[model samples]
Target: MSQKSAPRPPKTSPDATRRSEKSRRAIYAAALELVGEVGYAKTTIEGIAARAGVGKQTIYRWWSAKADVLLEAFLDLGEQAAEQAAGPGAEYGIPDTGDLAADLKAVLRATVDELLDPRFEVPSRALAAEGVVNEELGREFVAKLLDPSLQLYVRRLRSAQDAGQVRPEVDPRIALELFVSPLAQRWLQHTGPISYAYTDTLVDYALYGLAPR
Candidate 1:
């Protein structure tokens, strides 16, 4: 068997790290803002570079295409959202406080907050609307931006399964969507109002289901 590789060294200097962080933040903000203002069709690497006040070569040095830039920018948006919305030491992972209902409620509530934030909402809707008509971009977006969060639900549901809260035969992936998809649909389609009450009901409905449990 191949031996385990050695761990990589940590970032050494605070200044270098800060510079990297600043550049990354600027790029993400520029991408999101540009997409929001101009829509995805008009969004370009050059536009992001201009909005970010960075050289075009700098963006090219980091990402190959506009899609990559937007996707990574969305990912960075998620990071910033979590940081601002969640408490210190909290992360994107599912809460495992042992009360599955509470954890789900907390997460959904936070998601409701994020979906309402203009910083996240505008760009996301622009991209999502484009995805509705663009198959390749849709799949790519789902794979990178969406699947990671879905996996966290999988983990939480798996734990609930182990604890005899969720049924063993239930597919965690689909079960998670029973709640997730509804909210996403509501937000993306303007099908209904997204609120804490809405999400709280979603958690209850997903767990007990709509079959009068």
Candidate 2:
């Protein structure tokens, strides 16, 4: 008997690859827009497929649930924002310019701008509201989406410590909250105006401490 050969891997054409990417982005855009407009509970995979102008099978092939789709979509959106702010090839991380305060201010000012973006704000609010009531999603999204960004702060703070800008004994994770929490509360509560100036002041207070030197 002749020996059997292993099956060859399927090859995809460049045009086909481009088409796949286009469809994926369309799905992400549709998912975000729908969730923002209707809230997560009301948003459906079918709706996303329809808005994306792709078959339901296309979405099903890529994502098992609306949550998964939204998760990836938000991640992609963040990447796009980073690219716009930091230029092409920008991966998400805090920029260290040796001057920790100036670097923090730059990042936070970008954050202030992001909060004001309608494309980001609406869908984010929907997801955040859901996370508030749904404990599982709350933990999941926080861990997956929010924690990465928080860790970047940790990394930056640790670097600051190495440079003697921050106290060596300080916990980078906890120390970051001094600046981050105030901005988070303002955006979530809509209790105060958010601006670069406000974030700059927060950074000043956080880095130098509220007491006099």
How much lDDT does each candidate structure score?
A: 0.90, 0.93
Taking the tens digit of each residue's C-alpha lDDT, what string does model 2 give over 1-97? 9776976645889999899999999999999999999999999999999999999999998899999999999999999999998899977788899
- Top model number, lDDT: 2
TM-score of 2: 0.93
Cα lDDT tens digits, model 1, 2-79, are 786986657669997787678878998999998999899999999999889889998997799999999988987788
Off by over 4 Å in 2: 1-10
lDDT (C-alpha) at residue 56 in model 1: 94
lDDT of 2: 0.93
The lowest-lDDT stretch of 10 consecutive residues in candidate 1 is 83-92
